[model samples]
Each structure stands twice: as structure tokens, then as C-alpha cells.
Target: MFFATTALALLIERFIGYPDILVRTIGHPVQWIGAFIAWLDARLNPESEPGNRLAGMLALLALLVVTGGLALAVALALRKLPYGWVAEAIIATPFLAQKSLAGHVRAVADGLDRSLAEGRSAVSRIVGRDPEQLDRSGVARAALESLGENASDGIVAPAFWLALLGLPGIALYKAINTADSMIGHRSPRYLAFGWAAARLDDLVNLPCARLTGLLFALAAYFSSRTSAKAAFAAMRRDAHRHVSPNAGWPESALAGALGVKLGGPRAYGGRHVDLATMGDGKSELDANDIRDGLSLYGDALSLLAVIAVLLALAF
Candidate 1:
């Protein structure tokens, strides 16, 4: 039943996406989660208290109780009604990023085709680094790298939790992810404060990140000039070298599959981070490579959908 629910969620998010009208009216679930994170930060993590790691942990505990508790209550209430499982799928659609991720990546390509400045602006929305420092190849690489990492984080990870523990599971995952995004920085402000959110996000995303890498590798098997073997080799050689434990897997897989190199020095608000390079391919990338990456990601998504169906059948 959970697998079937995930399949329906994939179909819905892949096609309809969340309607703009709905977003304008009630706002998105993530926005609501972000709001809660902000409120907690303002109250508990004040500027005067930079080393409040225990406070941060307690705040995260409060967040878990709120999000997980509310989601469980909703799931229990929905379970008693007819056709409620379909409602669960419909509700889960907003959590997945099938259409939005593709759209953002495509926008970067389109922007590059138009002008370099336009390309930088489009990529800036999706990437955290300084887009102004990017050249043509840099812009394209940034887009593709974001596509790789987010493919697992935004799509596969949530779906994995949804299929495993239903509504509460996904809600809890999203809440933790939101906290990590908000405060899990090495900056003095959050270095000690957001330790739990950052660490837990890494732990939860570990399995799904590797799963997404394998899916991308399998998808590459069907793509011309792309090798699953190369993807696997890249993952093994480069994943651990990355600064992040989870993001490296999918990024290396996609970079290897597409025969392109990603990850180098990137600047965030004038802070330079020298990241380990992933994939042993061409250092330069173009808009065409971004399109190829998109195609490969599409095939991987299809494979995930097929697996969901298989799970529904087998169970």
C-alpha cells in the first residue's frame, strides 16, 4: 500500500505539480516548515548565544514532536475513511520535486542559450555559490551539480521515507531537512547550535543517496556513450573525498555518466570552499551536457516509478 501511494505521488508530482493557485492561497508545506524553523531560531538561537548547542538540540526535539505528532494524527484520522490512501498520495505530491527540479535545470539551459548573465541568474536560484563568478562552463556545471544532489534529496529521499513509514515519516524528514538548510551551517552562528539537525540530516539521507546513485548508474546503462561501470567507479573513488557524506554519491554518478567533471572551488558570500572534484571526465561543460543530464535523470525517475509498481505487486 505504501509503495502504491508513492507511485501515485510520483505520477501526480511529475505531471500536475502543485498548482500555483493552491500555493498562492494556502502557501506550500515547505514554506510552513521553514516558518517554524525561523520561529525557533529567533526565540532559541539568539545572536548573544552562539554556543547554544543544547538549546538547538532541545529545539529540534520540540520540532520532531510537533511535526511527527501532527502528521501521525492526520494519518490516523485519514485511515478510518474510505479511499483515504489516495488522499495520502495526493498530499504527498507536494513533498516531491519531480517537475520543479527538471524545470529549474531546464531554465538554466534556456538562460545559457540566451545570454551568460541570464544563465548565471537562472543558476543562482538553484545553487548556493556565487553565480557571478561563473563562466559558461561554470554555470552549466553548477546547474548539473545541483540537479544531481537535489535529485536524491528532494525526490528519492522523501519518497523512500513515505514508502517506509507513511505520512509522519515524510513530514519528519522534511522538517529535519528544513532545519538543516536553515541552521546547519559552519558559520559561527550555527556551528554549534544546529549540530543535531545537520548530523541527523546526513544520517537519514545516507541510504537514499546511494540508492539514487545506483539508479542513475542503471539509467546510464541505456544511454549512449554513458557507462554504468564508470558511474560505479566514480562513486567508489570520489564519494568519500567530498566534503559532504551523502551529496557526493549522486553528483559523482551523474558526472561520470555524462562524462563531465563537477565540483571545484565555490564561493558562498565571499567564503571560498575548495571541494573535491567528482568524475574523471572533461573539465568543461556546455548547455548540451546539461540537457543530457536532464535526460538521464528522466530515465532514472522512470525506473523509480517502475520499482514502485513492482513493490506494490510483490507485496
Candidate 2:
């Protein structure tokens, strides 16, 4: 079920690109789902009367039960909809994009190689770093950073959730993640409201993120062009060093696999976010780094394919 769910997710994403119609409908409704859940949570407690740890735990349970139930219902409906699972599967295949990850990364590099201004603009969409003052190296670094972080957020995490819980699970995961991205900040407005969304997203991605790193190491090992042993070692050594408990795993694994360093100080919203580096090595990055990221994405997908095959055999 887990493996099929993963493949189905890949297939759906590849084909549909989350149709604008679906996005316009589901996306907004999903936001309201969060809003509804938040409202429920608030109703459970009065501001003048704070809840205790036990009350908090109960609230969490209630939230999960409600959210998970709704998600499960949606998954069942998607399965039964006129949209055949076969069609969904076909659409999902292209969405997986092991081949395209590198292409996207390369475009940024190629764009940068042509002009730093062009590179910065292209890379800015994917990365949170300031692009206005970027040079060649900065553009490359920002692109690499986006590649690493997004490999998890945009790929592995979605794959993992979908695999485990089907369409509803994936939908819910995306909702939580999107909410976190939008509102789960330490700002004055969302600190308390976004707490549940942020924490839940982190919890959901915890295992998938680590698994992605391991898959990355295995892929490098199998590639023969790279040292799998080194990749694995580097991942083990540096996976936990990044500020994001989950992102460091795959990013560090890729960095070690490709023999390049990623992560460092960057400007976000005009403020410099001085982050620790992941993987040990010089920070020099180029088209080659993007090449490695592309390779890793392929390897991870191949690994998923193998898992699918093994499951078929076992079943």
C-alpha cells in the first residue's frame, strides 16, 4: 500500500501538475480546513483560561482525529471518482520527474552562466535568498540550496505522505505544509495560531526526510561514478547539523555524494540568515553540483521502482 501510494502520487503529479481548477478549488478549501480546525481548537479553550499539558494533548488528538478522518474520506472519494486510478497513475508518472530535477537546476546555472542578473531572477523563484546582489557563485549556491530543500519539500515529503495515506494523506500533507510555509512563522501574528501546523508538518516529514538521504547514499553507491561509501559516511556525519532537523539528511547526503558543500549565510527578506553549512568541504559549486542533484533524484526514483518491483514479487 505504501509503495503503490508513492507511485500513484508520482504518476498523478507528473501528469496533472495539480490542475489549476483543482488548485483553485482544493487549495482554498484546504486553507479553510485549516481555518476550521483552528476554530475548533480555539473553541475547546478560552483565552482567559489556559489549558494544561493534558488538555493540549487532548486537543492534538481531537485535531488529528478530525483531520485524518476528513482526509481518509477524501482519499476514498478520489479513488472512486470517474477519474480512473489508471489515468491518475499515468498522470502521476511524469510528475515524479527524476529526469527533470537536473534540467530545472541546470536552467538556473545556464541562465547564470549567461548573465548573473538572469540567473538571480531565475533562481529567486525557488530560493528565499536575496538575488539582487548575487554573483555567479551566489547564484549557483542559491540554486543548489533550493535543489536540496525542495528535493524534500517538493518531492520526497509528498511522495512519502501519499504512499502511506493515499490521495487524502497527500492532500492533507500538502495542506499542512503549505500552511506552514504561509503562516507557521515566529512572527507576532502567527506564533500561536501556526504552532500546530508547523509542528505537525515537521512530525509528518521526519521519517521521509531521513529515508530520502539514505536513498541518496544508496543511489550514489550504485552509480559507480561516485563513492557510495563516502556519501553514506558524510550523510551520517553531517545530516543532523542543519537547522532543519529533516532537510539536513538529504541535503547533506547529496553534498557528500557530490563532493560539494551546501548551506551557508543568506539574506532573506532583507535580513541575513546566518545558517550553518551542511556536509564538509569547500563551498565551490557549479553546473556539476546541479548534475549531482539530478543524479540523486534519479537514483531515489529508481530506488522507489525497485521497491515497487519487490512489493509485486512479494505480493
Top candidate when judged by TM-score against the true structure: 1
Please give the CA lDDT of all the candidate structures.
0.92, 0.67
Task: Give the per-residue Cα lDDT of candidate 2 at 104.
Answer: 69
Q: How do the residues 116-171 of candidate 1 rate in per-residue lDDT, one tens digit apiece? A: 99999999999989999899999999999999999998999999999999888889
Question: What's the residue-level lDDT of 89 in candidate 1?
Answer: 86
lDDT of 2 by residue, 1-315 (tens): 556546655645544444557556666444565675566447654466544434444555555666668767655666787765454354334324443555567788778767878788788777766788676777777777677666777677767666665655655666667656754666645566556767887898898788777787788867766666767877778877788878888888777877777777888778888777777766766656666667666677678656754663564
Candidate 2 Cα lDDT to native: 0.67
Worst 10 residues of 1 by lDDT: 44-53
Which residues of candidate 2, in runs, are more than 4 Å off?
A: 11-71, 78-104
User: Each candidate: RMSD to true structure?
Assistant: 1.0, 4.8
TM-score of each: 0.98, 0.77
Give lDDT: candidate 2, residue 292.
60
The TM-score measured for candidate 1 stands at 0.98
